[model samples]
Target: MDSLRADAYLQHIGVPRPGTAGAAELRALHLGHQLVVPFENLSIHLGQDVPLREEALVEKIVDAGRGGFCYELNGAFGGLLAALGYEVTLMAARVFGEGGRLGPPYDHLALRVAAADGSGPWLADVGFGRHSHFPLLFDSRGEQSDPAGVFRLVETPEGDLDVLRDDAPQYRLERRPRQLADFEATCWWQRTSPKSHFRQSLVCSRLTEDGRVTLSGRTLVVTGSDGRQERELPEHEVLDAYRDHFSIVLDREPQVAPLDA
Candidate 1:
């Protein structure tokens, strides 16, 4: 990677420059940006191939002013951290949704970044559709509070990890580091299958310094340091919420046909 251009990627994902910023600040920047940017598949539904190249991904995200599913978001952000002089590794993860089944291969891509001291690399995932805004400390058997909510990482019988939030389990992650191409087929299946949740809901979210906000289907949930609230809204409100919170334009909007769901 061209080091100068790579430095630009650091700014693209909002990882702060070490010349002034610290770890906590960098973590906050990344977490908040991911939430604000969203993790949507509108482009895919509209016939855009989520590209793998770092330049293309950055162009789409920062220039076009859009958000994307795991690959585009995390993959591009991974490039950013690497350029920022962080020891960043691309890790693969599997989703554990309501039914409690492990999602297929390449369901998610997260980052493992080591601190300057190398105490242990942290699990920082900004791509998960719904997740904590700050980096989840990798060395935890305990829960921690972030701008999003309370979260914890628990090891499975297989030694992999599962992310739990609000006492509800989310995705299970493998220990293996992954490549971007590993996720292409999985993304295709998700967008095309009736079984995928992304095919069922119109979601847009963002994490902020105080809390996180999300519009899921017809429901809008806003959580802050004080408390959180969830309420149902009309379709127009949902669309407006997407544009307002995440800056995503759902031109076809999932509400009309309900996303093949």
Candidate 2:
């Protein structure tokens, strides 16, 4: 990533360029990204290709004022961190599904970021929706608390780390460092396979100051301090909701694909 594009990304996330890349700066960037860039899977339903390259990820998220799922969101954020002088490594994780079954390899993408100040190699993930607001200590075994929930990293006998949220297992992360290209096959599967959940739903969501707002198909759901509220939006209002809530302007609303497709 070039200096100009890096600056633009920082601006897009509403973060200032830090004089030094440190733990504090990293925390700010992580929260800023989650607050602004949504976790969305509209492209799959929109019949668009989801590329895993850095240049394409940057173009979609930064230039297009759009958001994407794990690969695109973490991929672009990792690039920005590297361009800003932080050591960023892409890591593969298998998401834990129902009945404690693990998803396919490369089911998820996360980052291990080391600050220039030598403070930490934190687990920085802005793509996982409803996750920790800040990065978790990569080396810490004890419980870490965030506004979202309590998190812990448990090391398995096999040396992989299991990420827990409020005592529930979220995913098992491999320690091996990975390249962006390594996730290509799984990324394609998520986009094209009818069995993949991303292919069955249309969702766009982002964190808000008080809580979160999401558009799942035509239903608009808002959760905050007061409580949770949900309402189905009319077809004509769908595009406006995308623009008004997510800062995403679309020519038309994306529809959910047939489950058997």
Question: Model 1 lDDT vs. the true structure?
Answer: 0.73
Report how far residue 77 has shifted in candidate 2, in Å: 0.2
Give the residue spans of candidate 2 off by over 4 A: none
* Stretches of model 1 off by over 4 angstroms after superposition: 1-16, 20-22, 217-241, 249-261
What are the C-alpha RMSDs, in order, of all predicted structures? Answer: 3.3, 0.8
lDDT tens per residue, model 2, 1-261: 999999999999999998899999999999999999999999998889998999999999988999999999999999999999999999999998889999999999999999999987899999888899999999999999998899999999999999999999998999999999999999999998887888888889999998999999999999999999999898889999999999999997798867776
Query: Per-residue alpha-carbon lDDT of model 1 for 170-256, expressed as tens digits?
Result: 888888877777777887777767777766555666666677787766788898878999999875676677678777666656552
Residue 144 lDDT, candidate 2, scale 0-100: 98
Native RMSD of candidate 2 (Å): 0.8
| Predictions in order: lDDT | 0.73, 0.94
